[model samples]
Target: MSSLTKNLDAIRQNNKIGHFRYTIGVTLFGMQLINYFDRVNLSTAGPSMMSYFHMSSTEFGIVSSAFTWTYMIMQIPSGLILDKIGVKWVSRVSSALWAIPTFLTAFVSGLGPLILLRVLLGVVEAPNTPAGSKAAGYWFPLRERGLATALYDSGTKFANVIGVPVCAFLVLHYGWQSAFFFTAIMSVIFSLWYWIIYRNPRESSHLSKAELEYIEQGGAQEDAQPEPGVNLWFVLRQRKMWGLMLGNFAYNYATFMFLTWLPSFFVKTLNLDIQQSGFMTAIPWLFGFIAEIIVGGWFVDHLIKRGLDASKVRKTTIVIGLSMGIALVGAAYSPSVWIAVIWFTIALTGVCVSAAGFWAIPSIIAPTGLVGVVSSTMNVSGMIAAIITPIITGAAVDATGSFATAFILIGVVLVLGVFGILVLMGPIEQMHPERNDSNATISR
Candidate 1:
C-alpha cells in the first residue's frame, strides 16, 4: 500500500503544469509584438513619410537603417547588463524607455530628428532579445526551450501579420504619425504589466514546489545569476560562437531587409497603393507566424520529447529553413503580385520555422549562467548585417531601378550561412567553463 502511494505521488508530481511559466511566455510574446510593431510602422509609413519629406529611396533607407547603428553597438553591453541585473528590472526599464523615442517620432519634423529618434529607439530596445533568451533559459526545461523561444520570437512575425494592416489604417485615416502613437501606448502599458507580473521561477509565489522540481530536474536554468570566472574573451574565443554569429547574421540580414522594405516593395515594385501593400504584406507574415508556432515551436519540441536526437533535429531544421531563403530569387523575378507574395511567403515561412530552432540554441549551448552573454554575442553579428541591409538594398534599388539585385545578394548570403552552420556549429550542447581539454571543444 505504501509503494502504491509513492507511485501515485510521483505521477501527480510529474503532471503538475506550472501555469505561471506560460504566463511569462505570453508576456514575452507581448513584448516582441510591441517591439516589431514600432519597427514595422516606420516602414509601413515609408512611402508617405518619404513623400512628405521629399526623400528618395536611398534617403528613406538611411532612416530605416539608422535604428540598427546604435542597436548593434549596444547588443553586448545589454547582454552584460542582463547578466548582472535580472530580467525583470532590465525588461521593465527597457520597455518603458523605448516608448519615449517611439512616441517622440510622431513629433519629429525633419530627417535629422527622425534619425536621432530611431537611434535612441534602438538604444533602448537593444536588451529585448537577450532578455527573452535569459527569461526562457530561466523559465523552461530543455525539451520546451524551442517552443518557449518561439513563443516570444514568433511575435515578430505576428506583429508583421497584424501590425501592418493596423498601421496602414492609422496611416491612411489619421496620418503616419498615428502609428507611432499607437505602438508607444502599447509599449507603456506592457511595461507596467511586465513589472507587476514577472518573477524568476525560484522567487515566484505562484510556482508549485512540484512544478519547480519538474523544471529544475528537466534542466531549466532557474538561477538568474552569472557564473564566476567567465569572461567576454572566453566566449568570443569559441569557434562555435563564430558559427552562431554567422548564421544569425544571415537570418537577420534577410529579416531587416524585409522589415524595412517589404511594404515599399509592394508600393514601388509591385505598383500597389498603401492599403493594398499593407494587406498584401500581412499575408506572407500571417503564414510565417503560423508556421513559427506550429512547425518551429511546437513540432520541434514535440520531436525532442519523442526521443529524437535534439542536435540533429535542430541542425536539420536550421539548414533547411535557411536554404529556403533562396526563394527570394524567385520572388525577385516574380511576374505577378500573387506570385511574388507566394515566393516571399515560402521564404519567410522557412525563416520563421528555422528561427524556432536557432533562437533556442543559445540556451542549449551557453556555458552555465552565461546564456545572456552568448545570446547577446550572437545577436551582435546579426545586428551588423541588420545595420547595412537596408542601406544596401536601397542603393541597389536606386542604381538599377529594380529590387532583383538586392534579393539575389540576400540569397547568396544565406547560402554562406548554411555552410557556416555545417562547418562550425559542431553540436547543440552546453559548454563547461572549467574544461581545458581539446576534446571539450564543441565546434573546433
Candidate 2:
C-alpha cells in the first residue's frame, strides 16, 4: 500500500493526531501575544518615559513613529524573505532580532538612542504579521481559516488587555525598564518554543496522514513551494492588491491611535493617573480581543460553512466591521470619561470584528507561493499609518491641546477604508490570467 494510504488508515485509527492542528495554531497565537506585548509595554511606560527624557509630546510621537520607519520599508522585503526562507527560519531569526533591541530599550539614555533602538525594533518585527498570516494560510483550510486567523490576530488585542495591566504593575514598582526586560525575556522563550512546535504540514512528523490529506483537499497549501521565476508583477497588477493595501491603512489608523496614544489619552484627556490609565486602556482592548477571536474569526467561519459564498461573506463582514468603526468618533464627543471609554469599547469591537476576515483575505485568494508577498503588501498600510498617525496625532494635539481633530481625521480615514474594500477588492479568488472575471466585474 502507498504511504499516503497507510497514513490515512493510521489517522482513522489514531486519536492522538486528530487535533494537532489546533496546537500549532495556538502556538502561533502565543507568538503574537509575545510580539504585541513588546509593543504595548512601551505605551504603559510612556508617561514615565516622557518625563525622564524631558520629551515634548511631538518628540514622543516622533519616537513612536521611529519604530515604523524601517518597519514600513521592510514589509515588502520581509514578505519576500519569509516566502524564500520559509516561515520557520524567518520567524525565529526575526524574533531574536527584535528581542535584542527590546532588551536594549531598558538602557536607552536619550531620545536619540531611544529612537534608534525603536527603529531596529521595527525592522526586525516587520516580518511578524505577514509570517503569522502565512501560518494561518498554510496550516488551516478555507473552512477553518477565519477562526484560525482570528486566533493569532487576537494576540494583539490580548496583549493590550493583559500586557497593559501587567506592564502598569511593573512600571509602578520595578520601573519602566523592567517592563522592557520582561517582554524581552518572553520573546527569547517564544523563539525556542516556536522552533520546536511549528512546521509546515508536510514537514511535520507528528501530524497524521489523514489530517494532511484533509488540509490539501480543503485548500491549505500543503506544498508552499514557489514556482521557478514566479511573477510578482502579476500580483502587483491585480486590483485586489491595491484594495487590500488601502483598506489596511484605514483599519490600522484607528488601531495605532489606540496602541500608541490610548494611555496618554486617558492621562491627559480623562485626568487619570498612570495606573488608572493603564488599567482603563485594558478595558477597550479586551472588547477588541474578544471580538477578534469570537465574533470575527469563529463567527465568520460559521457563516461560510452555512452556505455563504466565501467571496460575498468575507467582504460583507469586513464592510460592516469598518462601518462600525465610525463609533470611535463618538468617544471624543462624550460627556464623561467612562462614557468615552464605553464608546471606545464599542468602536474597538466593531474594528476587531473585521480582524479575522481581513487576515483571511490574502490567504483565501492569493496564489500559492505568493501568499507572503500578497499578505505583506496588504499589511504595508498598517505600517505606513503607524508611522504617520503617532507623529500627526501628537503634533495635532500639541497644537490644539485636544484630540478632537485627530479623532475626526481617524473617522474620515475609516470611511475611505470602507470605500477601498467595497469598490476595489474583487471576488475572493486566486489571481490568474486564465480567469474569466476581471477586477471590474468584482467592483460592486
**Which prediction has the highest lDDT against the true structure?**
1
- Per-structure clash totals for the candidates: 0, 0
> Each model's C-alpha lDDT?
0.86, 0.84
Question: What stretches of model 2 exceed 4 Å from their correct place?
Answer: 1-17, 225-230, 436-444
Model 1 regions lying over 4 Å from their true place: 1-15, 224-228, 434-444
For candidate 2, what is the TM-score? 0.94
Q: For model 1, how does the per-residue alpha-carbon lDDT over 123-209 read when each residue is reduced to its tens digit?
A: 999999889988998888776788899999999889999999999999999999999999999998988898888998888988887
Candidate 1 clashes: the total is 0
lDDT of 2 by residue, 29-86 (tens): 8888998897888888998999999988899899888988998899989888888888
